[model samples]
Target: MLFIFGISPKTVKTDQGQFVCPICKTRSAYEIKTQRNYFSLFFIKLFPVSKPRESAVVCLNCGTHMPKMVLDH
Candidate 1:
């Protein structure tokens, strides 16, 4: 018997809002994303092995990920 199993991270867009990008230093559209770790078997997603709601803020223009403090402002 042979089986291939591994964990993969998948990022999903959850929300969008306007924010000032620290890296780009400009007001732009930011996307809120959540990363979920999935267990894969035979190249197919079987189940999630970690928390499915880890979030991040991404700048649309510069494509830089911002810290959680960026969302507070």
Candidate 2:
């Protein structure tokens, strides 16, 4: 018998909204996401294998990831 198992990183979007991108300097759509490592079996995610990473604000237009503090404005 053969078994396949591994760990992989996964990022999930938690929220989306409009915000001013610090780099773009304009109002644009942004996504709030968190990343975590997960245990995988046969290429399928089974469970979390590591702690959740810091959530970030990703600008859709510019594809730039900014700090969560950007949402305050």
Candidate 3:
């Protein structure tokens, strides 16, 4: 019997809005994404492991990831 089990991270886009990028200083489309770790079996995701949800805001123009504090304002 052979079993392949591992953990993988999957990112999902939760929201989309416009925001001013601090680095680029341009109003551009931004995407809010969340990443979660999943338990994989034979390269297929079976369930999620015990891990905190990771969130980030990305700018479409300059591809910069803005900090949470900056995005709040």
Question: Which candidate has the highest TM-score of all?
Answer: 2
User: Taking the tens digit of each residue's C-alpha lDDT, what string does model 3 give over 1-73?
Assistant: 9999899988888888888888898988999888899999999988888564867888999987765566777
* Model 1: residues with Cα > 4 Å off, grouped in runs: none
What's the lDDT for residue 21 in model 1?
A: 88
| Off by more than 4 A, model 3 | none
Sort by lDDT, top down from the best:
2, 1, 3
TM-score of each: 0.80, 0.91, 0.84
Model 3 lDDT, full chain set: 0.83
Per-residue lDDT tens digits for candidate 2, residues 31-73, read 9999999999999999998898999989999999888987876
Better of 1 and 3 by lDDT: 1
Q: Candidate 3 versus the native: TM-score?
A: 0.84
Clashing pairs counted in every model: 0, 0, 0
Worst 10 residues of 2 by lDDT: 64-73
What's the lDDT for residue 50 in model 2? Answer: 88
